[model samples]
Target: MSIAIDFNHVVKKYGDQAVIPGLSIKVKEGEFFTLLGPSGCGKTTLLRMVAGFNSIEGGEIKFDEKVMNDVKPSKRNIGMVFQNYAIFPHLSVKKNIAFGLENRKTPKAEIERRVDEILRIVQIEKFKDRLPENLSGGQQQRVALARAIVINPDVLLMDEPLSNLDAKLRIELRNAIRKIQKEVGITTVYVTHDQEEAMAVSDRIAVMKDGYIQHAGTPQNIYHRPANLFVSSFIGRSNILNATLFATNDKTEIVIHDKHRVVLTNIRQELIKSTKTNVQVCVRPEEFLFTSDTNGLKGKVQRSSFLGLNTNYFIELESGETVEVIQESDIDTLIPEGSVVYLKLNQAKVNVFNEDGSVNLTEGVKNDAAGEVQSEVNNVAI
Candidate 1:
C-alpha cells in the first residue's frame, strides 16, 4: 500500500558543515517525486534520510503521520533499489525477488504468488530462472526491481537506479519503470543526477542545491518557467542574456547593449521605476527563430553542427554575447559558419530574472484586461 512522506524543517550536519540545513518538503501519497541535482548537492543524502539510512539532526520525518525520527531502517518497511542492482549472483531471478518476502516470514504459497506477479510486472518472468550473472544489465536491474516491489512496501526508494546502464538501456528501463510505478501505485522517492532521467520519469521533481530545494514543480514548469537563474541554467540549455529594463511613457523596453531591444509590455511593476537595476532574459536554445529581417538582433554564426534531428548553431551577437540555437534539420540548406544572421526570440517562453536571482513576477505574462499573469501556465501544482 502507498503512503505519504513528509519532511518538516529537517536538518543534517557533518561535524561543523551543514549538509541539509532546515529543509521542509512534502511528498503526497502515490506520487512519483524525484530529488535531482548534481553530485555533492545532497540529493542522495535526502533520499537516505527518507530511507532511515541517514538521521535527521533537527526536525521530523513522518510516513503518513507516523513520526519516524527514531525509527530503525529495517522497520520502515520501505523497499529500496540501489544503483548497483544488489542482486545475489548465487540466486536465480525468482529467488532474488523472493528474498524480501522470505525475510518478512511470508507463507511459501503467498511468496510464490507475489514473486510471480512482480516478475511479470517488471516484465522479467522469462528470465526468472536465470542467475544475475547470466542476465544483461537491464535484465539484472529488472530483477532488482522485482525484488523491491514483491514485498508491496508502502514506499519505494530508488537511488540512481539507472546510472549504471547505457544510454539505450537507460531510456528503455526508465520508460518501463514509469509504467510499472503507475501500475503499482507506490509512493516513490527517487534520486538521480541525470536531468533527462529525472524529467522523464518523475511526476514532480525537486531541484536541489547546497542541500536546499531550489525549485519544486512539474518537469515542464521547471524547464519553461524556472524560478531563478540557477534553475533556468541548470534544468536545460538556456542562453542568459544581460538586459536592462528602461521605463518609457507608455511601456517598458528591455534594452540589450543599447542597440537592440525588445518591447517589454509584460514586466513586473517594481521594475518600471527609472532606476536601472540588473536584469537578465533566459531563453532556451530551441526558442530562437532565424529571420531575414534586419529589424531583429544581428549575429554572426561562429560554428554550426548538424545532429540527427536538429542543427545547432553558435551565434555571436553584436554585443559579443554568444547564443546557441537549435534549428530543425529539415531546412533546405544550412547556414554556413561566419554567415551574418538575424535572430528573434519567440518571447512566449522567455523568462526574466531579477538581480537578486528571483524570477520576475511578470515573467512570461500575457497582458490584457486581467493583471499580469504567467502565460502557458499549466498544472502549476507541485
Candidate 2:
C-alpha cells in the first residue's frame, strides 16, 4: 500500500532559530519525491518531521488522512534509510534485516519469509550470512535498505542514503533503489543536495532555500523555467547578462552592458508589458555558436579546456566581460587564447529575466522558439 503525505503550515524551531516556518507541500501516492537543496536548507528537518523524529511546532503532518503531528516514530509506520548505513557490525546481513521484524514481535515463520523476500528484492541474498564489515559499501547499503523495507512500511524516507558510497557506487545504488521502489510501488521521499542525483531520480523535486521552498516541479520545469534568480543560478550554469529594456514601435531590444544590443522577438511583447526597472538575459554556455562572421559579438578567447565530448572556451568580449562557451568540436582546431572570434546568440534558446531574476519568458515564447529550432534539428539530422 502506498501513502500520500501532506504537510500543512508546518514549522520547526530550536529555541529562537526557526529551521522550518509555515511550510506546506504534498507528496503524491507512490511517487518518488525528492527534497533538493544546499546544506542547512531544512530538507532533513522536514523529512525528520514526516518520520515523527522531530516535533512540529505549528500546523500538522498527515499520512493519507490521519494527522501525524503527535504520532510517535514507531507508530508512524515509516522506514528510514540514513546517510551512514547504520548496520550492526556484529550481526550478519540476515539478522540485520530481521531486526525490525523481531522488534514488532512478528511470527517466526513470517519473519523468515519476509526477510528472505526483501533480500532477494535488493539482490543481496548471496551475502545474507556475511557480517556488515565483510560486505562492500554497496552491499552494506543494500542490507540497510532491506532492513528498512522488511517491515512493509507505508512510507519510505531516505535521507541521503547514497552519500556514503563512492561516485560510481552511488549511481549504482541509486539505480537499484529506483528499480526496487518501482517494483514495490511504495511512496518515497528522498532528500539530497546532489543536483544530478535529484534530477536523475525524482518524479518531482522541491528546491529549498533557507527555511522555505524556492520552487517545486519536475526536473524539466525546474531546469528550463526556474521561478526566480536563486533558482536560475542554483539549478544549473547560466550566463546572466545585464541589459536594459529598449522598446520601439515595431520591436523591443536589450542593450547589453551598454555596448551591444540584441533584438528580442517573442520575448519583446512580454518585456514591453512589464513595469520592472531592470532586466537580465540568461544564456546557457551551449546556446552561443562560434562564427567567423563580423556581425556577431566580438570576443577574444582567453582559455580553452577539453572535456572529452566538448571543448569549453573562456571568451572575453570587447567590453571586458567574460563568458564561457561550450562547443562540441575537436581541440585540434581550437581558438587559441587571444584569438578573435564572433559569437552569435541562438536567440531562440535565450531566457529573459526580470529585475528580481524571475523567468519572464512565457510558454508561448518557448513554443514559438521550439517551432523554429525544430527545423534546425531536422537540417542537422539530414
Candidate 3:
C-alpha cells in the first residue's frame, strides 16, 4: 500500500559540522513530490535520510504513523532509482526485473507471471531477452525502472534519474516514469536540480537552499506567486526592479524608476500597515507589454532573438538598466534595434518584495510543511 512520508525537525551532521539543521516536510500518499534546488542544497541528503541510507540526528521520520529512524535500508520496503542506470551487466532484462521476486522466494510460476507483466508495463517486453550491454540508454533505464517497481515497493525514491540522459531521452523517460508511477499508485519522492523537470512531473515541489526549504507548493503557485526573492529568481527567469510602495488612505501604489506608477489592489493589508517604503519588484519577461502610449517606461531595443513561438528582446531602459522582454513572434516584421519602445507592465501578475528581499509582499503564498510562513503573505489553502 502507498503511504505518506513525513520529516519532522530532522537533523544531520558529519562529525561536528552540521549539514541539515532541522528540516521538515510531508509527502502525500500516491503523490509525486520533488525536491528541487541547486547542488549541495541537501536535496539528495534528505532523500537518503528518508530511505534509511543516512542516519537522522534528531526529530523523527515517519511513513504514515510508523517511525523509521531505526529501520534498516533493506527493511524500509522502498525502491530507489539513481542517475546512473544500476542494472546487472550479467542479467538479461527479464532476469534483472525478476531478481527481487526470486530473492523473496516466490513461486516459479508467479515469478514468470510478474516478470512478464512488468515487462509489458515498462514497455520492454521485446527487449526481455537482451542483456543490459545490448540495450540503448533509454531501454536500459526502462530495465532499471522495471526492476525497481516489479516488487511493488511502498515508496519510490529517485535521485536525478534522468540527469544522465540526452535531452530528448530525458523528456521521453520522464513522461514514461510519471505515467507508470500513476498507474501503480505509489508515493514517490524525486530529487533534481533541473527546475523544468521538477515543474513538468511534480504534483508539488519543495525548493531548498542550504538545508532550508525556501518554498513548497504547486508549480503554478511557486512560479506565479513565489514565496521570496530567492525563489522568484530560482524557479524561472525574471527581471528585478527597484520600486517604492506608498500607501495613502485605502489605496496603495508602487513607483518604479521614479517614473512609472502602478496601483496594487491585491497586496496584503499588513504591508500597507507597515512603515516600509522601498520595495523590489519581480516582473517576468512575458509580463511586460510593448505599448504605443506615451505614458510608459521608455526603453530602446538593443537586440532581439527569434525563438520559434516567442521573440526575446533585450531592451536598455532610460535609467541604464537592461531587461529581457518576451513577445509573441510577429509574422509581419521584427522590431529593429535602437527603436524606442514603451513598456506597460501587467500589474496584477508582478511580485513585490520588501527592502531586504527576504519575504514576498504579494498575497496568496502558501506555507511549507513546517507550518511557518517563508514569506510575509497570507496563507493559501492548498
Candidate 4:
C-alpha cells in the first residue's frame, strides 16, 4: 500500500534563516526517490519534515493527497532506517524485529508469521537468535532494515544507511537494499551526499543546493545534462570551459574562449535564443577522445594513473587550464607524465551554461550523451 508523497511549495525556517525555501517536488507511488546534496544543504531537514520529526513552517506536505503537516510520525505508518544501525544491542534479532509488531498488539501467531517472513526477506533468518553485538556491520544493518519493514510500512525512508560501512560492503549492501526495496514495492525516499550512490540507486534524483533544488530528473539526466555550473561540477568531474556562443546564417557556433571553434548543429530550434554573455561548457572526463595526432585540442599530460579498468590522465590544455580525461584501458600502454597528446570533445554531448551558473538551454538542450554510456556498458556484456 504505497502512497505518492508531495511537497507543495514547502518551506522550512529556523528563526530568521530559511532552510528549505519554496520547494515543491513529488515522489510517485512505489518509486525510489533521492534527495542528493552536500552537507548543510537541507536535504536531511526536508526528509525530517516527511518523517514528522520537524515542523513545516509554510506550505503543505501531502501523502496520497492528504495533508500531513501536523501528522504524528507514529500515525504516519512510515518506517525510517537511520544512519547508525539503531538496533537494540541486548535484544536478539527475532525480538528486535518483533518489537514493533508487539506494540501494535498483533496476534501471537500473526507476529511470528510476519517476523519470519521479514527475516527471510532480509536473508537474516539463520541469525534470528543472534544479538546485534554478535553480528557483523552488514548483518546488523540487515536487522535494522528488517525491524523497520516488518510492520509493513507504507513509505520507507532511509537516511545514509550505508555511510559507515567499508567501500566494498557499501556497494554490496546498496545493491541488496535496492533489490529488497523493489521486492516490497514501498514508496522510498533516500538521502545521501554521495553522488555515485544516488545515481546507482535512485530511479530519479533531485540535486539540491543552498535550500534550492537546482535540478531534478532521472540519474542519467542529472549526470549527463546538468542544469547549471554547480550541478556540472558537483555531480561528477567536469571540465568547465568558458566560451562565446553566436549564430551566423541560422548556424550555432561556440568558440572556446573565442579561440577554438566547434560548430553545434544539433541544438533544439525551440531552445535557441539570444544571449548577452559568455557561455560555460561542461564536458565529462570520459567524453574526451584521446589520440596521438592533433585532431582536436592539443595538450600535454601532466600526470597519469592506471586505475585497472580506466586510465586517468591529468592534461594541461594550451589554454592554461587543467582537464582530467578518463579513458578505458583496453590497451596495455602508458602515457608518460610529460607527453603531448590530442583530445577531442564530444560536442554533441557537451552541456552549456549561462553566466549565472544556469544552463544555457539555448545550446545542446537534450540528454543525448546518456545513450553513449549505455553502449559502453553493453560492450562489457555483463
Which is the leading candidate under TM-score?
3
Error of 1 at 147 (Å): 0.7
| Range of the 10 consecutive residues with the lowest summed lDDT in candidate 1 | 367-376
Worst 10 residues of 3 by lDDT: 373-382
How far residue 380's Cα lies from its native spot in candidate 4, in Å, is: 41
What TM-score, over all chains together, does every model reach? Answer: 0.92, 0.88, 0.96, 0.92
Clashing residue pair totals per candidate (backbone < 3 A)? 0, 0, 0, 0
lDDT of prediction 2: 0.81
Question: Which stretches of candidate 3 lie above 4 Å from their native place?
Answer: 371-382
Give candidate 1's whole-model lDDT: 0.83
For residues 5-30, what per-residue lDDT tens digits would candidate 1 score against the true structure? Answer: 98888889999888987777789899
Give me the displacement of residue 153 in model 3, in angstroms.
0.6
What lDDT score goes with residue 130 in model 4? 89
lDDT (Cα, tens digit) per residue for candidate 4, span 310-345 = 999999999899999998876768888998888877
The TM-score, computed over Cα atoms with residue i paired to residue i, of candidate 3 is 0.96
Per-residue alpha-carbon lDDT of model 2 for 269-292, expressed as tens digits?
533554333587777899889887
In angstroms, give how far residue 202 of model 3 lies from its true place: 0.4
Best by lDDT, which number? 3
lDDT of the structure predicted as candidate 4: 0.83
**lDDT score, residue 86, model 2?**
93
lDDT by residue for model 3 over 240-272, one digit each (tens)? 999998877678888998979989887776655
